[model samples]
Target: MSANSSGVVKVGVIQQANTADTDANLAKSIAQIRVAAARGAALVVLQELHRGLYFCQQEDVDQFDLAEPIPGPSTQVLGQLAKELNIVIVASLFEKRATGLHHNTAVVLERDGSIAGKYRKMHIPDDPGFYEKFYFTPGDLGFQPIETSVGKLGILVCWDQWFPEAARLMAMAGAELLIYPTAIGWNPQDEQAEKDRQRDAWTTVQRAHAIANGVPVVSVNRVGHEADPAGGAGLDFWGSSFVAGPQGEFLYRASIDQEETQVVDIDLGRSEDVRRIWPYLRDRRIDHYGDLLKIYRD
Candidate 1:
């Protein structure tokens, strides 16, 4: 796809905490989207599950009630807003595919208020307070990019951000930009040093993706703390939503402790120049990488 009429495009990310009330969370996200659009953002991306609190902190059968169909309420509301504002919108949802099936899906709304494509989260993490396997099924949609008026979006969810293969496939598929709508945070029980290390690693890995793929990356994570309703200490979501250029330079970064809506201009044309100089894609050793599909080489 060719670059927009101008060589630059403005993208925005919403990094705000969610409340237990789904309606309230949706309203907050809508308000932030309006703010971003008012400030000249052509494309706006929201944090993962922006409609409610991070329910995956602890598995509860009742949490399943939160899941809805793709064309359900959340998309209807956001789709209208996308058309009214005339901007591309990316939203993450808890999808209720059928009675017994569900997925952690991300939906892209085109500038004219139509569904572009969806990507189900492939990597589902199950850890201490985070018990996701009990909730979401693994995504069946392969690493495909969603083409839109702005560009091709390589959309991935929280845990999917950690895998180089996911990012690599998206780039090889011709994704102009990579996006992660994440909900990661610090374990309240962990020491300050460990928290810092975890946060730094998260940012570093995403930056490396941009450098390797020759595409800009936009990551939006929620802010503030949400308690673990099952009993233990909750997670303090570190809101360091950021944007990085194809060469891995920072374009915009939000604070770790505050709720913010910011727009950053990206030079889509830069990717062509970066790829020409650093031809990582052209030099790939494809013939020797057949083992990448194996679970283990043993």
Candidate 2:
């Protein structure tokens, strides 16, 4: 399709498999970003913690070494690539803020190779296999969108994708699109039916976010299986990375078990048209939402 009358932005999502080698992983990411740019993507987003495997699968203190400062090696490489490719890049990192302080930060690099802004993953999950709370400090930065050359991006991480409040807040704060860099998967022990339900629920919630907020949603998840460090069943990361339009329509979807770098064209002007018809934002009863701030009513 040619450029839309309302203007179009080509966004790319990179779904990749990570290994133990950090250098190799970064090289793979750089190569994928170049592929996306070659396909005419103006903005590209990599999977969560693309530098290595999902090390948060276990709460090993040794994982702390994975955290690096904002201006560290990863950002430097991504920034230079963004400049060279003239594309806005959203990258998730294990951020080493200070001594004993680290976060799951999503960094945005502008087309000029400078750090535009960042969003720390607000929702840290600590489950049976995915133990992230042990590694990341809960983000202090509120629900804010990072302004980029392409548009305002409401960047979030894996666990944060489940919360609708976060998406609404970003939409209210003028986010053009909601983006998630995620690393979620299923246990081998679970039944195939259960796994299908989990994957469906994951996609449904994010698409609902797009429908409710009148903004598009982009979710990029990792592919391949990472062995459990604690010697149990490994996780088969369901790699159905996808993009949804403002009306919650599927624009693009990647394979469940392959490394994909896909570029999808999003019409930014469609939000205006959809919002005018739905008007969910206009009909909100702000006075009754005080209960949302409470933990429980009963």
Candidate 3:
């Protein structure tokens, strides 16, 4: 409802760190969301795993306890808030789909406090510090856009942001915007130069997606250092959450170490104007892209 007929929408992004206290984290998110609503945001996005600390730093059986049903308590609370504010809310969570089956999921709450849709993270990474494969089942749901009151949302999770195919699939399916609820950062062992490369690469690729698809991109990330539960050096989550326009222009960018809520107004109608000039979609060589389905050209 915050979006007018002219394709102008005010979207909000919440970037904050989490702790062991899940209740406090949710409360903090709620308060920030209210602040965004006060700023006239029609849509609000939260960072990945906002419910608690980044538990994936180590593989522990107890971490499974954090997973809850999609329509469970978190949605109930967030949905109620969305209904009260008459806005759309997109939240990322650790989903307990079934016994012995869990997935990292992003749930979208409609203006009426109903479950609009959910996207289970497809790319589950098993890297050293990010041991997500231990906890999440690779998402079965294919790349698809969820229709909301404001527009069609292409919601992806933390690691999924790295893949162009995921973004393309969503954009192809008529998504108005690409959204990433992320939890990424640096390990203490990494050098400053390495960290810079990683973070810059992260932002650059997403901006490319916006330019290619002629749609805005929104990325929300947590900020601060989350320690490894296994008593090792932890990750310093660089919370440089940002929003970019269709031409890959920066709309709003957050600081690396602060908890913040920002509302940015975007003219969604501008995508059409941009696409008319660039016409990337019209020129795609679909016949030559069959090889993209393969793991590698070799």
Lowest lDDT sum, 10 consecutive residues, model 3, at 1-10
Candidate 3 stretches with Cα past 4 Å from truth are: 1-5
Task: Give the per-residue lDDT digits (tens) of candidate 2, residues 203-228.
Answer: 99999999999999999999999998
Task: Compute each candidate's TM-score over C-alphas.
Answer: 0.98, 0.98, 0.98
lDDT of 3 by residue, 1-298 (tens): 2221247889999999888999999999999999999999999999999999989888999889999998999999999999999999999999999998999999999999999999999999999889999999999989999999988899999889889889889988988889999999999898999999999999999999999888899999999999988888999999999999999999999998999999999888888788889998899999999998898987
Per-residue lDDT of model 1, residues 4-99, tens digit only? 222677998899988898999999999999999999999999999888999988878999999999988888889999999999999999999999
With candidate 1 superimposed using the best TM-score fit, by how many Å does residue 235's alpha carbon deviate from the native? Answer: 0.6
Q: Could you list the CA RMSD of all candidates, in the order they appear?
A: 1.2, 2.3, 1.6
Residue 196's lDDT in candidate 2: 95
